[model samples]
Target chain A: MTGAPLLAVNNIEVIYDHVILVLKGVSLQVPEEGIVALLGANGAGKTTTLKAVSNLLGAERGDVTKGTIEYRGERVEKLSPNELVTRGVVQVMEGRHCFGHLTVEENLMTGAYTRTDGRGAIRDDLDLVYRYFPRLQQRRTSQAGYVSGGEQQMTAIGRALMSKPKMILLDEPSMGLAPQLVEEIFEIVKRLNEEEKVSFLLAEQNTNIALKYARYGYILENGRVVMDGNAAELAANEDVKEFYLGLSGTKRKSYRDVKHYRRRKRWLS
Target chain B: MADLFFFLEVLIGGLLSGVLYSLVALGFVLIYKASGVFNFAQGAMVLLAGLTFVRLTQILGSEHPWDGMFVLALAITFAVMIALAFAVERVVLRPLVNQAQIIMFMATIGLTFFLEGAAQGVWGSQVHRLNLGVSELPIIIGDVLLPPLDLVAAAAAAAMVAGLAVFFSRTRIGRALRAVADDHQAALSVGIPLQSIWVVVWSVAGIVALFAGLVWGAKLGVQFSLTLVALKALPVLILGGFTSIPGAIIGGLIIGASEKLAEVFIGPLVGGAIENWFPYMLALVFLLFRPQGLFGEKIIKRV
Candidate 1:
């Protein structure tokens, strides 16, 4: 791990539309050139945490009511999302929100909107993305909406890569994909971290896949981090194995293990 | 031969007017495409731009058409439109960000009434002549005489549409715009500023409004009635697909040519004034066949 974390979320609290609290005191960090995963199920404030770091919560009428976010040791809680991008932080939102109307290449091009480095550099990066995602290159001219779900997910990640970010805040990269596709994407992510040197703060519900790749992991539940540790440590935890990994020392959970293995003796019994 | 010439003239005239309708609809498409707001106030924006231009020209002395007043008034009126766009973005859209699409639509409805009243109150409800220096005299071509003013207006509209089409397809800013329109959250996440794009789109729509206002004001005379031209564009938008730029132009052309042909040929058989309601009937029928409109993205259902 690097000497200092690349990105830090210091006890942030997010509230939507001034009423509903979403993320409550969520704190996490991504070390430089490290893959850190934020693990959770639906409504566990996983997406909200990533959005807070990227400063994208404002558009959804969401406010980071408390705490500060730091990127490269500079406070970035109040910067506009684009400014954060300029400073080398990009977020690939969940649902693979590729521009449905645009061609795959065009969707990737939009990622370079704020780039003043001229077309040549952007073009080189585009070719780089195509190299990393050969499937995207094959479907370059197709409308993104018409592509398979896996391709759309790849396009979303490829779009994020177009920005040439120092760090990526990727939310639910494996959502709604098949097991094979999920593993394939995580594999590409690991390579990007190693080769491109882009730090990632990944949010995922697929705990088994995430723990397999991520160097560190934080488990969130009901708007707060329930546990956090090294990937192997988190993977070996008995509760994590039972709830998230679905592996109570078996290839798959049997009916009894999944349902009611803990039927204990009560006073009446 | 004489009947054919007359038919040709009617067709040409209708097509020319239809291009003007497309001009107004183009403004709506810009805002709608970028931010998903069906800006009902586009007509009001047209009225304001027309009034602002005509009054400024008179205030600066209208006799100096080739020299001082015309270009100066146009520039000033365009500035006013941009400023209005900025103000609307701040006052109307900014607060209402993330509100339901229907609520935004309704806000634009309120904006329509407010702007209509504001334009009249500020400029006074007086009819003013707007001569864009295009000669009103008809030009004879073979057996038919064509109005030069309508021809000029059609050319201007064509040029603007071409420029916009190229800008959207060829430029980075344009791609960013489409991205913003497709998904605000994703756009922001990828570093496209949602609010800035909104302001730019509204401003571009404002520029379009200025051009539309000038042409329509010249043809119909600048007055309260100028706002009603926005109504003509509605049928055009429905036919073109509210989200597509080329659809607006094509829709406008279809509406214009058909309504005129229908009015001329079918009017005698029926009562008359088919021009009054023909476009709407056509648009209604089109909705039945293609709800997304020509060139509009198909509405995909998950079920």
Candidate 2:
């Protein structure tokens, strides 16, 4: 919201298989050393926005047909995902995709694949990752497939850290984890932001947690941004409270009452 | 005592032959690991390498008996293998990126035919002698007899396997390859170039095929039928799993030894020639218990 944004996605449209339009005129930005949260329900183009930024759309036969994506003052719409990694923009994909067969350490080393730095620097970075996610260091030699879901998520983030990225596009970090684990992971993300100064544009369905951690938040519905504001403002908004946080400001009511009350909202109608 | 000694000879011989089968199967495993393509052209590639080496050797030998001619012939053969690697990567793999696995597999089958035809067309279908300077005479070791050529092949296969083990585990490219094998998209996300990895992998597989061809052609001859030896590697692959390098080696040894032993012991019960179907039968029976093969990871379907 201040100086030039670190990453700016400008009115991008994505189509899959040359037929189905997935994301329509989606736009958002993350300033340098800032965390932005993309909040949406299922099928709301949250993941698509992340993919569009990282240039991973081509693998799934999806193309960014309209608009542009800029990172660090350079247009990155046409670059390959690996090229983006070289420029220090990395994405942790939706499903916590750890190389299941590789050892946990091997998975982390792969994150450093784009870096030309010497072994000593890479090792120091590995130690830095371990300090953040100590669980990963403990399971460093275990096959990633055998690790627990929380550990796998840590490995994914740790692997991203090995690249020494300037920013990370995190997709659904709290997808299948317990609530406590989710909180723990988000705290580390917060610490990393504050200490390492790595920016994050995380897409999350858990709006309560996402907004709590992110400095700025954007809410998407049906492939378009419906609302956005500062974290505190969005949390205090009435519509977001009822729909996203499931918090009804008024008195408690039965299921039928809630359904009837929801139909009365102007946005839903 | 004499019969016991003969049995020992057969077992040792079978193991050595199994090493040869592993060599060819290694070619399949390398390509399959990198690109997820079941390269049916591996056999034809082997044939092409062998024929090219032998043809070059003959032409150069006829000119002079100089030792440099042999080195030149080998150098030319290596260049041919590298050229084939580039051609396959560019023409077959790059265009077919992100296609269905079955479609890629079928493309490799088409590649098999194309390569087979090209090899025959260019080198002529006549059988050519391949002498890699290894003696064909059987060497007597203690009470058992072994073919010196088989010993050489086993040593070569062992060295190649060791080299590959070091490559996959220690080197950066090797680690990237293992990552590519795990998940192509994840590998791409980490900034590994999928196309270049495919080319490097295809080139390595080509080199493996060339070595396989040299050994097999020396044992038999550089004829069209030499391509059919790749069929032997199929059973090896089925037993070893399509993805495991060690699986290929072990599976090759199992198939090679079992087929030969069956031919020696069980052949008399049947009308003989059980070698033709023994490995397949063994693989089928083995698959009945472990469908993923010896080293292949068990597929866990998550809803």
Candidate 3:
């Protein structure tokens, strides 16, 4: 309750090959115990922002040209992905990224890669992850690739939990899922947040569902934040409504007009 | 009758040689399985181990007799291989872990050149006799004369393969290695130190290489020419899956037997030197039909 932000993503810009400016002046904060959501459309640089923060932006070929990322007030911009994991900054990545040949249990065990706890303690936590995700326990010995999409997503999140991370940067947890599964996944996320007090900064395209779980939210459009506030406030905003909420308003026409206007602005610039 | 006996002799000889080839191939499979890198320098590592054993025996046992010299030489070589494995892991593999597969593969090729030069620099470029003194007398039972050295090579290869199988399937370190081989990122997340696993694998591969060198040296005098024996292993690998130990063994036996048979029965029809190209030709045919090799996992590419 009385400490610096768990993670501070200051005005950072990420460019791919120095030409494809993916993330332009992006910034966000995750309090020690809060669920922060990053909402954006496809290719809105949500994943890029997470990658940049994780110090895993694939070197100069995919560089974060500007801005600073600090975790617990320590600059982690220059650290390797493994170093970031060691510092307890773990990302559950966009896709499941589960080891296809490994069992669900093995996959979960990998999450605790950075941990140096006793085997029994690790086993106890693994049981806890299984308790939270019963389906994984049921299919513990099964190959991860053979699991259903929903189950794979659960395994991914569960794997990250094994690390006992200070904060998790979830990239599109609900991607490529059935609606019911999406709801189930988000419900689990909400439960995890309330029960464990684990911090999360989820990048998601499903605004309606994302807003339901996130206490605070930032809306990204074309690599920049156009709207930011409490989830409910932003959910109610005209711009957020017109663009993401599918609400009919003058903001809808203006949003579409800006796309056309941006081309002209680009030409002039 | 003499012609048939000669045919059988060559067949047995080739099969024995193939067993040795398979042993070397197993080393390749172990490293490749743990890490996706083909470890093109596996051949060089084998030659290096062979040279090291010869040099150690010469330098360490010159005053002493050759009684337990073979075992002592092997022990020294094992230690050297382990150190070499660590060096390669820290210096060559660790930095190139995130690089492209091609780059990693090329780096191993470079490693091959470095090892070859270093081996020659250390052992010099002379053929030395390694009389394993393990009863080279051929056991004659009925009409068959089986060389004890050949029997030792075959048994040793089988025993080593079995031992490796048990190590991988039953041990925690082996399980961790398999996990790293399956998915490096996932393995990292689980807290498996990839560097440690790579070192262990390379060390194990090095041990296997030394064992191969010993058996092979017993049959053919140890020299730079010993490295050329590793070429037969390539065909064995092509026949066996890149990561499959059994594939290497079976592929080796087939290549070894076929080449000898070709030399004995088919050599007269095709002039000579069929032994040189027979394994490769067999491997090329296997490749055309089953590119994944006998034991390799089939990778289906989808658009």
RMSD of 2: 1.7
TM-score of chain A of 3: 0.89
Model 1 segments more than 4 A misplaced: A250-253, A263-269, B300-303
Comparing to the true complex, what docking class would candidate 2 get?
Answer: medium
Report the TM-score measured on chain A for model 2: 0.97
Candidate chain B TM-scores, in order: 0.97, 0.96, 0.93
Across B156-275, the per-residue lDDT of candidate 1 in tens digits comes to: 899998999898999888888888888888898889987788888998998999899889988899988888999999899999999999999999998999999999999989989989
Residue B36, candidate 1: Cα error in Å is 0.9
Best by DockQ: 1
**Candidate 1, A186: how far from true, in Å?**
1.4
Candidate 1 chain B — worst ten consecutive residues by lDDT sum? B294-303
Per-candidate DockQ vs. reference? 0.74, 0.67, 0.29
Error of 1 at A173 (Å): 1.3
Question: Which digits, one per residue and each the tens of the lDDT, describe model 3 over residues B1-303?
Answer: 867666677778788878888988888888888888888888788789888888888877643436576568767788899999999999999787678888999999899999999999978978878777678678875456778888887987788889988887655677678778877765654456688899999999989888888777767778777677777788999999897888999888998899888887798998988889988999999989999999886552212
* Candidate 2 lDDT by residue in tens digits, A1-269: 89999999999999999999989899999999999999989999999999999988889999999999999889999999889999999999988989888899999999999999899999999999999998888999999988999999999999998999999999999989999999999999999999999999999999999999999999999998888899999999888988889887777668988666663444655
Docking class of 3: acceptable
What does the lDDT read for residue A232 in candidate 3? 90
How well does model 2 score by local distance difference test? Answer: 0.90
Q: Which candidate is the best by lDDT?
A: 2
Ordered list by DockQ, greatest first = 1, 2, 3
Best of the two (1, 3) by lDDT: 1
